[model samples]
Target: MSSSKNTLLIILAFFSIYVIWGSTYLLNKIAVSELPPFMLASIRFITAGLLIFIIAKLMGKSLAITKRQLINTSIAGFLFLAFGNGIVVWALKYVDSGFAALEISAQPLVVLILMRVFQGKKIEMMSVLGVILGVIGIYLLVSQNEVVSKEGSILGMVMIFVCMVSWAAGSLFVGKADLPTNYFVNTGYQMLAGGLMLLVGSLLFSESWSSPNVWSEKVQWSMVLLVIFGSIVAFTSFNFLLKRVSPEKVATSTYVNPIIALGLGWYFLNEVITAQSIIAAVVLLTGVYFINTKKKLVIFSRFHK
Candidate 1:
């Protein structure tokens, strides 16, 4: 592809991950209001996974895989989707979508810590400082009287934190695990496994299921959007961006997503954005930016591996 074409494709890919994924938070909140969280997640992932798997097969991608690959992929899927996504959906019942998004935004920071602890990666002072600031930001964001007004809110915040940890762990695991060679096929298997796990959880919990006749239009539309735009399009774009751009640059979506989620929540759901939350967002995103950016300062160079 020409340089101009490549740039345009990159822009489009960036837009897909940044906007579509951000919007999923709000849609998830809406979906969970009517459906059980695990069931909702299960449906979304299963539908998306089946569609993607079909498309990949049509494209001549092999669906065959080893037992070990299936096992590893299943484990990754459980961590990333069954817990990471399912719990966040449940938490949305007690927290604002924007607040959940903000809490989940700390995922990259968690990934950094995990890498340092498990992979023996060298951590720079600035990265450490950024992690500290991110923790402080999270503290400030959740410490507000309005935020913890309900007892469930505290639990909700805790669940969101767990979601971040799960997602980070899954991401780290995927880097080292044996899986399908085709990215789309691997992702499809992960989704299918995770979705099945979630469905079983839903059954164990005995979650109530409303009939389709009673399902609201908004809930139906939101679920459809999630399967199409959130899962399929955004995921494809994210993998595409990983191949085309620096991982750090692609990770910029993490910072941008919260801002988009906050705006959408405030506009559509009339979610309150307090002064404290704004300040916290600024502090948190600044810390994230510093962590992701490569510094040329001499002091920072000393920590490089």
Candidate 2:
């Protein structure tokens, strides 16, 4: 591809992931208002999975995979979607969407620590500083009067933290695991597996299955947006960027997503952005920037040497 086209595609992919995925936090908050979280997540992933699977097949992409690959993908799916996303959806019942986004912004810090502990990766000083700042930011965010006053909000924040850990672990696992060559096909399989797990959880929790008529128009529309823009467009773009750009560059979405989510939540849902939250967001995003960019700077220095 020409340089211009490559740049354009990168910009488009970045926008998709940054804007669409960020918006999903607020949309999910809206969706779980009426629907059970597990059921709603299950339906969203299953529907998107089946649709994407069919589309991939129609496009001549093979869905063939070894048993081991299937198992690994399923495990990743369970971790990333069932636990990570499903739990957040449940927590949204108690937490503000903007607050949840702020909490999730620490994912890079979690992944950084995990990589060092499990993989024995060398941590840069900047990354370490980033982690420290991120933790401080989170402490400030959760210590606010708003979060403490709300019943169960503390537990909800803790659950969101766990969600980030699960997502980070799943991301690391998928990076090393054997899976389908086609990104869309692989994503479909992952979604299907995750959706099944969510369905099982729904059953175990005995979530009420309300009729479609009972769902508000906003909830219904939010679900549609999540399935289409959040899952299909943003996810596909994310996978595309992973292949074309440096992973650190692609990870910049972490810094951008929270801001977008905060804005959307404030504008649409009247979610309050407290002074503490704003300070935390700034600190958290700065940490994320350092974590992602410091390694690239190191690499550039090495090349120059």
Number of the predicted model whose lDDT against the real structure is largest:
2
- Tens-place lDDT digits, model 2, residues 203-224: 9999998765778999889988
Q: List the residue pairs that clash in candidate 1.
A: none
Instruction: Report model 2's TM-score to 2 decimal places.
Output: 0.92
Which candidate gets the maximum TM-score versus the true structure? 2
Q: Can you tell me which runs of candidate 1 are displaced by over 4 Å?
A: 1-12, 239-252, 295-305
lDDT of 1 by residue, 1-305 (tens): 79999899889999998889899999998889889998899999999999999999899999999999999989988987899888999999999999888887777688777767876776677778888988898888989999899769999998888888787777666655778877788878888998999999999999986665678999999999999898888876765555554333455576678898999999999999999999999988988877876562233223221
Question: What lDDT score is found at residue 147 in candidate 1?
Answer: 89
Indicate the worst ten consecutive residues by lDDT in candidate 1: 296-305
Per-candidate TM equals 0.89, 0.92
Regions more than 4 Å wrong, model 2: 1-8, 241-251, 294-305
